[model samples]
Structure formats: C-alpha cells, structure tokens
Target: MAGREEQLLAIRIAETLSRAAEAERHYVKIIEGSSSDELEDPNNDDLHDAEELLAHRTRTAFRECQMLAERLHMPDFAKDIRKKLKAYGSDAKLTSLTYSSTAGEQYCPALADAWGFYEPMAAVALGGAVTGLSVLETMLRNTAKIIEQAKTTPDRETQVRDAVFGILDSHSWTRAGKLRLQRALKHTNRT
Candidate 1:
C-alpha cells in the first residue's frame, strides 16, 4: 500500500504521462499531414498547435500542484500559484499563460504574432521538421522528469538554442546532410 506522499507522486506521474501521450498523438498526427509545403505555408501553425497542446499540459501541471497542496493540506503551496502568476503581470506574454486555451485549435496569426519567426522557421525544409521533433522530444522528457521527481533540471532554457545549433552548426547545403535529416522523418508520413 502506498502512503499519502507516494500516492501524490503516483498521481502526478500519471497526469504527466497522460499529457505526454496526448501531445505525442497530436503532434504525430500533424506531422503525418505535413508536406514540405505545409511548413512553407504563411499560416504555418505547427508550433501554434504545439502551443495549444502545451498550454493544456502547463495548466495540468499547475493543477497537479494544487492537487498535491490539497492532498497534503498545504494552503501556501496552492496560494503560491496566484503569487507566481501575479509576478508576471507586467509581461503580458508570460502572464497570458494563466489562461488556458480549451479549443485545441491552431490560430496561425496568433502563432505568428507570438513567435515572430514562424514563417521563416517553416521555410527551413527538413531542418525545421527534424529540429521541431527533437525539441519536442527534449521538452517532453524534461517535463516528465520534472513532474515525476519534482526536481528542477537546467536544460529547458537551452533546448531551443541547442536545437538550432545542432541543425545549423554544420558546413553547407549538401545532399548528404539533407538526406540524413530527411531520413529522421522516415517513420512519419507527410502528405
């Protein structure tokens, strides 16, 4: 029989795993539909779709915190969320995370406005696809570890910079390099 602490951890792990599975299915579906041209679309909402997925995941993470607080009878832990969110009041971008997007739909213009580099990023051909998949994998992995272990790991901030460097740090546009990355998507179906 699990103790209360163990039960809380188990619930947190279950919630995290559920969100990861949901995100995987959503992204895998989108990737299956992605053609080379889809990335090139001015309305490329790949990351935006991801944002919606993550917004839900993020909300769930906070909810898990509240769950833990409730189960443990720690009022301060639950109250901290409001204080933390309030701290971001000046930066509306950061503050907006408090609002969850229920629709699970992509708003490309919002994505573009939020990202500012979406269309340009989309034009990177296979580089964009490979990089996006890699980043998502890293993020999901870190998120899992964070929830399961309740430890703060350092790599999340560096993931994007590292991914971009991994994709572009090489020499030139060679057939071999392009082919290598294209091969990474072999398991994926692009229409």
Candidate 2:
C-alpha cells in the first residue's frame, strides 16, 4: 500500500536495476565465453560495446537513485552518493569492476580471482543481497544519512527502509523461482 510517489520511485528503481543487471550479464557472458579469457574482447566488437554499455548503465544507477533521493527530499544524501559513485563510471577506473554499497565497500577486479571480468557483487541484483542486507544497502544508508545530517523533522529512516524493502519484496527484481534462498545458502556454506 505504498503512496503513488513511493510506488513510482520503486518502479523507477526496479527498471534501472533491471537494465543494469542486463548490461552486466551481457558483459559477463562475453568475458566468460572469450577464448583468451582475458578482459580483452578478443576481436569481438559486440563484446566491446557490451562492456562500454555496462559501465555506462551501471554508473547510471547512481543517478536514478540520486533522483529518487531528491524526490524524497534528501538532497545532501544524493550529493554524497553521487560523489562516491563518480569514480565507477566508464571514464574512470577502466577495465575493472567496483562497487560501494552500505555496510562496506566491495571490489570486483577486471581480471579477478577466477571470476574474470565479472564481479559477483554485481550480480545485478534488483533486491538487496539474498544472503544479507539489501543490494543497495550502502547507497540507501547514504540516502538516510542525509536526513540525519540535515536535522530533518520527524524520523523518515523507518519509512525509507520499509519502502525500499517493500519495493524489493514486490518481486519485480527477481526472476521467477530465483527467490529461493535457504538452499543457495547451504551450497554457499559448503564452499
């Protein structure tokens, strides 16, 4: 029962997240399928385009989140988040996968530890982590910080968290039957 504004924001976030995930998957598949297994495209122009598009699209999530924060009246939070995300763009940190979300900063190397160009953190999750906090925990926390820092009236943190979690739980971010978690966790613990 979200308000229209929150509903719209959630839809926007979901779409942006979906687009980013698609781009990452396309790029990762190309990287993983390459004969050389190097970060290079291996004479594949499509792969190069996919790589460029991933960077562009991934960085764009920041803007969409920023805009949502503004609508939520958290200008300072949006600015801070954008500042941190600035380095992750295609123009910066070329040939690597990097992510900074709430709870901590995470890194995904281009020629990574067996994952190659793809970073698992960039699982392109629409929801938060299946195993832990939300995928955008750090970004959302950054948004919350604006309220704390600005000394805004009333407590909006609960609403923010609820809205975010609710949006994620709405199932727009997950593929059908992919929401199963306990089994995945058992397998992960074994490794």
Candidate 3:
C-alpha cells in the first residue's frame, strides 16, 4: 500500500540521517585530536592535510545524504498513525532539519550528552545550519577548559579520560565513519 511505502521511506530516511550524524561526529573527533600539534607532532604537515581532506569529504557526504533524504519526501507520515502519508507536492523540498525546527534542536542536546561537546541550549540558539560548527567549537572550548582545570585539580587525568571515552562511546560507526576510521588508522600506523 502507499502508506506502507511511505513508512518504509521514512524509516530509511531516519536511518540515513542517523548514519550521517554518526559520520559527522567521528570526523569531528578526528579533526579535534589532530588539531593539536603538541599532542601529535608539529611537523606532521601531511597528517594535518589528510585530516583536513577527510573532514571536508565527510561534511560533503553528510550534506548530500541530508539533501537526498529531504528530496525523497521520506519524512512524511500520517498523523497519529505509524504509517507514511502521501507526499504533497511540497514535501519533496521540505526539510525537518531547518534551523528553527524541533529536529534541529534535538541534535544539539544529543551531541552535547553523547560527545561532551557544546552546551545544547546555546547551540540551539545559534541555529541549526551551523550547529555542527558550533558544537565543534564547544568541544574545543571544553577541551581547553579541561586542560586548565587539570592544572589546578589533582583528578585531571581521570577527567580527561572520561571526556575522551564519552566522545568515543557516544559516536556510532556508520559506513562513512568506518571508511574514514580505517583510512585514519592506516595513516596513523604508517606514520
């Protein structure tokens, strides 16, 4: 039935979005880790270049997936029912990920709790289009804060360990994430 078809499409779109989010998160992690020369190596220009390329590719892929999901009219569902609704003409161009939309707000909190990144409420205020960037900045700020706090606190190592693990565990591996991870790991090993 048409309803069933729509439902399936919606599920597909949701899964795709989830995958894209996971990939984006992973790339952010890699970029954050590589950004510090002292933690890594100041002279490793090639590694930095490769990380930048991977981050660019990941962002492009995430945007494409989001656009495709919106274009497919996959998010249309029936009211109060677990069925897909018929797509109106305008559905194709509609995106739930709009800056002012509820869905956009959801990403901020999820990112904060899962990755220990930016404050969700602050990110939501900045708007969704740049939510990813905002979150990244928040993560960097949090990292700097942690370092500063560690200098004054005796439990700095434990706090840093928890923060790192929070990021790693909150991230779900998608196809793109896996590919990037493999490449990064290989590159790391080679160096």
Candidate 4:
C-alpha cells in the first residue's frame, strides 16, 4: 500500500492536473474566439477583467506545475519554468487590450493622433479580427479625439469637462465604469 505521504502527493498532482486542463481549455477558447464570430462584444463587462483573469489563470497553472516539479526533486526545472512564466506573463500583458488602452489614456493627444495604427492591435486583443476595430478601440479613440479637440480651444479645461459630461449623458458605458469616470472627473475638478 502507498504511504500517507505518497497518497497526499498523488492527490495534489491530480488536483494540479485538473486545474491545468481547465486552464488549457480556457486558453483554447480565447484563441478560438479570436478567429470566430463568438468573440465577446467590446461593451461586455467581462472584457474589463479578461486580461487580469487570463494572466492569473496562466500563472496559477504554471505555479502548480512548478510545485509538482520541485516535489519530484527537479529544482532546476522548476526554477526555469518560473523564469519562463514570468517572462511570458510580462509579454502577454504588454499586448493585451487593457494594457494598451490604459497606456494610451496617459497620453490621449498622442494616442488620438496615432489611433489608426493602434486600432488593429486593439481589435486583436479583444479576440476580434486584426483588420477591424473593436468597439472598445473606437470608444477610446473617440475619447482621445475629444481631449485633443479640447486642447485646441482657449477654454480647454471647460471644454473637456463639458465633453466628458456629454459622453456620460449620451453613451452606454457599464455602470461601474461610468461611475468611476464620474468620480474621477469630480475629483479632478475639485483639485
């Protein structure tokens, strides 16, 4: 009969394998979605969390596998796996829509001026066609354009405030996102 320690190790391995399989399925779905019509719409609230979720799941699976490798007395292999996973996570994040859009937000005028070049990558990150612009890309591009246009006016701050309020009134952003934007606007106006 197997010892208690052996049984426990087997159980842990089984659980880790199960998790790895699930993560693989998730990754496959994301990849397939990129080429299929089933890709999520840009307005989906889930899109807001996809990048973090993907990275988290991938890291979790790799960590579990690394632990298993260490348990099997393969320290060097485990360390190598850790290094590779870290590098992959960083690379994936840089290409993600969430990262790209958030980075663009930091320089709205430059992003607006270069939007055409950015749109295709944004679409691909959303699991859509590389040739088409995702709705999220369109929205970000429009928002940047608004900021850029406001920059040309004498009363630029007021114009930006009005434009932001107008968007809040007219668009259909997720409630949480909209609320966050509203709070940011109010906070900035106060300072």
Per-candidate Cα lDDT values, in order, are: 0.45, 0.52, 0.40, 0.48
| RMSD to native, candidate 2 | 19.5
Residues 1-191, model 1: lDDT tens digits = 22446354544545564564466456546755788787457687874575457455544444554555444455775576445434433322331322227655433222122222112222322232345457647645565444434333445644533443334445354667555655554434353
Can you rank all candidates by TM-score, best first? 2, 4, 1, 3
On TM-score, the stronger of 1 and 2 is: 2
- Model with the higher TM-score, candidate 2 or 3: 2
Count of backbone collisions within predicted model 2 = 4
Best by TM-score: 2
Tens digits of lDDT, candidate 4, 85-169: 6655462542233223755422112112123322322232333222123543564568767666546453566666566556656
TM-score winner between 2 and 4, please give it: 2
In the order shown, the candidates' Cα RMSDs to the true structure are 21.7, 19.5, 22.7, 22.4
Determine which window of 10 residues in candidate 3 has minimal summed lDDT: 80-89
Clashing pairs in 3: none
Write down the TM-score for model 2. 0.45
Instruction: Looking at model 2, report the run of 10 residues with the lowest lDDT sum.
Output: 111-120
Clashes of each: 0, 4, 0, 0
* Backbone clashes in model 1: 0
Off by over 4 Å in 1: 1-10, 17-42, 85-191
Estimate TM-scores for all models: 0.32, 0.45, 0.24, 0.34
- The top-ranked prediction according to lDDT is 2
Residues 56-95 of candidate 2 have per-residue lDDT tens digits of: 6656656666666566566786676577565544543533
